[model samples]
Target chain A: MAKAKLDKEKLLWMYRMMLLIRRFEERTAQMYGMQKIGGFCHLYIGQEAVGVGTVAAMKKGDYLISAYRDHGHILAMGTDPKPVMAELFGKATGVSKGKGGSMHLFDNEKGYMGGHGIVGGQIPLATGMAFAIRYKKSNQVVVCSFGEGAVHQGAFHESLNLAKLWNLPVVYLIENNRYGMGTPLERASAVWDLSQKACSYDMARATVDGMDVLQVNEAMKEAIERARQENQPTLIEARTYRFRGHSMSDPVHSHYRTKEEVEEQKERDPISSFQAYLLDKKILTKKMADTIEDEIKKEVMDAVKFAEESPLPSLESRFSDVYA
Target chain B: MAEITFREALNQAMAEEMQRDENVYLMGEEVGYYNGAYKVSQGLMEKFGASRVIDTPIAELGFAGVGIGSAMVGLRPIIEMMTFNFSILALDQIINNAAKLRYMSGGQFKIPIVFRGPGGSAHMLAAQHSQCLDPWFCNVPGLIVMTPSTPYDGKGMLKTAIRDDNPVIFIESESMYGFKGEVPEEEYLIPIGVGDIKRGGSDITLVAWNKMVHVAMEAAAILEKEDIEAEVIDPRTLKPLDEQMIVTSVEKTNRCVVIEEGWPYAGVGAEIAARISALAFDSLDAPILRVSSEDLPMPYAHNLEKEVLPSVDKVVRAAKKVLYI
Candidate 1:
């Protein structure tokens, strides 16, 4: 395959999305500390490049589904941050009508299926969506994202086998952040290379530098193209890392990992590296990067305000939406 | 009207629905070239082609989730479970994803999927294969549980379930598939959450569903020989139960007997008995009685299986106890 040239406009947009996710997650952590956001809040701090770059490769009509650590994925899909933040605040005006909190954000109009709470529950759902695309005879594809921990689940294997058996048009992207809520990959999985699991289903597989947006985008574009053109599924493992603790309840450096290890990993921060790359490539200037950061900071703050002022769902709403 | 077996009625329901809407399709194990395990989907693959009548591998959880995923995006899928016993393997998909997706997404997705297959005791299939799981589904708020007693009811209720915008657990019986009943040639639908009076009388109200409705009918017949009349009511849709109908019948009869094929503890009969006590307590002339399967896993021996399940004798005994006869 020839090396596809990256468009300057898309590169700039990816930078903006990555920064926006970073700022949004930082504020979310603050809001969580203020007791504004409750429940299991998993921030996508270090995995911004994976979400931004992979979503950038998807077409307009294509569908995307992911696990609970999903604020970045939905934001990368171009969903308005206001409703997403309001949903985290459990407000009526929020997306999903505030019924789904941090772990269940949904933007149906954007083709962002949901922020599924279960570990690997979204795999079969994504395959099913791909089945629908084929059933409808459309050129659309589906991108399913899950954490590294989900690969050990039976749902993951079952869905992969079905997708390969039917030749469904889906890309099962694994965001391997090295931890399943504190349990390291070495402790949980016998096979270290998650991409090898795809070989069991006789499917295509790839592994990419998830911290680099350009590389992630390149790999995703090729896989998505294969899905749209040949109607074949691909399993791509994006090697990434989560900068924060698993959830709001856990400390940044838990007993499982030392503070020095977390600090060393932070040196290879995805946002700063991508920002430096943009500047060096002349696609984004220092002045432009500063301006984008300021804009995103304000935008994220506005979203926080919107969520703060939003009203709680009415008493009658509890009974509604349960049937239809 | 045409007389047809319960299996044929279900086949007709799937055929008519698939013909009516291009979005509706059937997918399950052995549903294609092999027909259905119970042959309920006989000739569907030949009629609709492989794309519509898909044959899935023996992966219940995977296929069940796939059906839900398809339904989420506007395709109506009828997922056959081979038997309700196998459906236990896909409970997470059915209960968590299918049932709760619409609610959890705040109504962003609608899972218009139907999971239908045989359930309950069939010959001596034993404990693993035979189970009356109506109460398990009935406990969930988002799911719609339906158990049709006759061919006519099965056909009509399944059509309604197909058109419904919610997940419907359409549990059929392995034993009742061969039973024949008169079904209308013209298209008709039995509205959900409505009960049917198989045999009406004044002495006592016999509440039953699925295969137990037949047991209640036989018990009603035995009660008639002793000059004790019983009204047999079948609440085909169990989740959104026809509570009003049962309460009204109990109000008139003032004596009620709840019959079910599941174990006694926390069973569907216990729920009905509780409702009767709450809704028509003052109307009762005697305490309501329940005739349920023995509180144990179904035994394999022919005599033990019969003894474990609800029979005409048990229903009659419960009816007599309720009526002070």
Candidate 2:
């Protein structure tokens, strides 16, 4: 099949975003090791394309909700890395005012609804946001992303069922990273094809290569369009892989799959592959790619500086924000 | 003021709120097409249409989460849990998401949602359907737990819960649905965290809420015949408890008894007793007593059900114990 051609500028922008998420996650992992970030850090290392491409397809007003591996999604939504890093550092200047830490990054102005920690918690919430958009007669769509593990949760199926029933303007985007905290899809789900879960709800569904940013973008575009135009929900299962363990606490190797398997998957790493594709298409020049890498690294370092310099939350701050 | 059933009062409150705000909507199982399982949302669908008043599959967790999500954004969602028994399935969304979202989101999102339904012992309904969950909801910090006993409180408090910028667990009683009380026809709202002195007395304080208010009132009447005046106080909201009202009444009476339909272990009565002891300890002439359901799952038999639940007789006995009778 012939590949769909994307605009050079759009492709380049997406490539930059992919690099940003990759670098951001790498830094986040290092920060977790340094104990700068605390409280359950789920890295989105290998799932960069899934977040970058899907976010590229979303409209300005559209909302994004994701599970704990949400740093990439929030960064892709264009939130400055400083506040997000500050949040991870538990500083008062964090996007969630330091209260939400790593697993609960929220930037309402950017329409990033949350970085929900619960596995399937954001599913129904995204569906409801879609319902709200329809209720208010708005064109906005909600893209709720979760791992393959979340597909087993009752909230996932329940939300999908209602999203279809209500014809909600939502996209239930499953970033199928294969393993659900050491348990593979074979062990976690009855059905290997996670997209087939949508068949239960009789909703529009598709499976895309999550390693290919272009493929993911195309699938997300169709899903988001169907949601915005037809007021319908779509279940897009992006077959991706998490390069890291389930969380920061998980060991780098041994058990659950060998180091060779990790190396084999790394050859198809979304960032490296997408960079090669961009270079092949001449959408990204050698100089542009190097500059992008340099810029992102500098930005990440500055974010770290911002986080380190940021003040910790005051004792009184803890009491505030509990209520409206 | 006009007389209305507790069901009708709830329906009116939802209707008025939906009419007042375009964002407010109702969603739950049988809420629309079936006119609600308990008929509390009877006319809401007809008045507001299917869009505003939605009927959902018996998926409690889904709809409860949908309500929370919509509330996170500008919408005010009133999710009906058919009965509080059914709400157990959605407690994750209610407690973890709805209650904690505002705090978790650092006040970026205010969950102006109400999870309201008939709770507590009702007729011969067995264990699964008749458990009272007021205390379970009250235990959560970010939740405003409302237990409306009368039609007036039901309507007024439901309105307040719908408008409040936090998740409100508005608990009603299935047994009290058909029970009629005077509800004002004019617009009104009973503030949350405020207790109402249903009846004035100088001898003893009878603190209760929801269906137990009826039990307390009945017991108060029984005590009246015994020449013992019992002040009846209904703490409409449980979490931001009306401590001042309870303590003042306890101080005035010098003795107190609490009544609730839930089990005695860590129940609403237990919490209130602790609060009263802390605030009104010096003024208390006797130890505060509690009248609660027997610590057992509700049985199917009518006689057994009656024995398991708090009753007027039980409330009277509790009051007598606290009164040193």
Candidate 3:
């Protein structure tokens, strides 16, 4: 609601949310190595600010859909970490009741539609949700997030065209993490600026520094307002980097950028930069930051314990939910 | 009661349902303004307006996923596939997303959508256009597959499918659109997963569906002069098959013959044969014989196409083989 300044508590809360996502993803990476979380697992270690800032700009009842690298997105949308961790552990208490693992986390009650697996699969679904919102004359906006690689998919182009043609209330967020499973954006995309791809559909588009939480939040605010007010659609390319490999199986150093490149990106870590901003502005003291770190560490540990103790889905659970 | 063509029945069903529920709308290529590719949605657009009867681009995958997404949030969308053959471009969305969305989300949302269009062999349309894709969709869970034969069944089943809170694959025959039948003027709905015994007899049992039902009836009529009484059964819904009705007919006839327009290897007929073997193995007099189209791409030549499709003679031959008459 406010254009510029926020109170001290809100800034600290945003910093703490980012820290939670960072630590949660770190634990998930460790769990993957230990074989506790099986199957394709993508970590959101460095892209927490994109989810945190975008979610901060969304209101209740606004829908969100994203690609496989989505743990941070749902967590930043105020979903409890307990079920998310339990889902990775394949427990019945998980958000999808152990049916959907890391790639398909869903919670309708929170308006988090899904974390779809196939590349660009959720684009049209999110566009259709915007259609539903418009048909019902509801002021809710739908935000769709996907990787730069998905820009090459037919669904991406078709959905964007329909969104603009119908003037649906939706925003397309492209988290440009430089590489899509070892292929750099330069090698994959003919156009260096991914946001301009929206130009073909006559839609509003922008590119922002994804590492800056405030900048991302500001961009999301404008996009969401435009969608809700004028029924316009926007495509925003958030320039960010993934600190980890594409997935757990990918080797960190071989056939891709060097270790130096990763370390260089770490210098611009979104969480570290945001924490420094708060301290510099006197909104947070050293002792207060230390206390928040301790609290988040305990929360992460509790999540792990909860996942370890949760029960696996029952045998009959397999037959249920096939139809409804 | 009124005598109406299958196309008019389909149009009336959609118009009635759209009038009943504001959430029910149709979206597909040429469904609006152009009425329909086959004129099955004629005059409904002028009544329901453009927002309700939407015309979409040739992007099947895109619009299909959009329909699934709208269904997730409580809007009932009927997505016409133009034709079942064109649905191949949208198979990823229909099978991967529409069929799995509910189960993958742990039953958090119900996809109340229908993907309907003409299917099966239609004249000399050749390989690409003439395809019966019921087997491909029937094999998937979280979907109800329905094939309606007559005007009454077409109107009633489409109405039920629109109201049902699940994804339905409604397959119709392009050749049978002009076939006329009596439909009640009063409101009515036909429940899915029910089979109809079109004509009852006692010597042998013949199972068929959709347009093939007419062929089965012709074959049965030809066999009647030879003193071989035949009972023709149409398992209208293929997925939730009326196994009890089929097994009962097999028990009484002591022989079975399956006919369909699709290939024989893995089709609805094959599924029916397997079910008869599993459920009524003890009641059989001979091995169940199948009458199916030759396993090759549909040829464009009229004579070759006629030879490729199963005819009344072929069904009679298969029936006599099981009957040993």
In terms of docking quality, model 3 is high
Output the number of the lDDT-best candidate: 1
| Model 2: chain A TM-score against the true structure | 0.98
Winning candidate number (TM-score):
1
Total clashes in model 3, counting residue pairs 3 or more apart in sequence or in different chains? 0
Q: How do the residues A1-324 of candidate 2 rate in per-residue lDDT, one tens digit apiece?
A: 116477888888888988888887899889899988888988888889899989989889899999988899899999999999999999999998899998999999999998888889989898888889989998899999999999989999899999988899999999998898888889878788889988889999999999988899999999999999999899999998888888889975569988998889998898888777777877788999899999999999999999999999998999998888
TM-scores for chain B, listed for all candidates: 0.99, 0.98, 0.99
Question: Candidate 1 lDDT, tens digit per residue, A1-324?
Answer: 112267888888988999999999999999999999999999999999899989999999899999999999999999999999999999998888988999999999999999999889888899999999999999999999999999998889999999999999999999999999989999999999999999999999999988888889999999999999999999999999888999989899969988998898898788898878777778889899889989999999999999999999998998888887
Query: Ten-residue segment with the worst summed lDDT in candidate 2 chain B?
Result: B99-108
CA RMSD of all predictions: 1.3, 1.3, 1.6
CA displacement after TM-score superposition, residue A128 of candidate 2 (Å): 0.6
Off by more than 4 A, model 3: A1-5
lDDT of 3 by residue, A1-324 (tens): 113365677677789999999999999999988999999999988888888889988999999999999999888888899999999999998889999999999989998999999899999999999999988899899999999999999999999999998899999999999998999988999999999998999999989889988888889989999999999999999999999999988876567799999999999899998988888888889999999999999998899999999999999999999988
Model 1 lDDT per residue over B1-325, tens place? 7899999999999999999999999999999999999899999999999999999888898999999999989999999999999999899889889988887788898999999999877888889987788889989989999999999999999999999999999999998999999999999999989999989999999999999999999989998999988999999999899999999999999999898988889988899999989999999999888888888888889999999999999898888887766
Residues B221-251 of candidate 2: C-alpha lDDT, one tens digit per residue: 9999999999999989998998999999888
Cα displacement (angstroms), candidate 2, residue A147, comes to 0.5
Pairs of colliding residues, candidate 2: none
Residue-level lDDT for B78 in candidate 3: 97
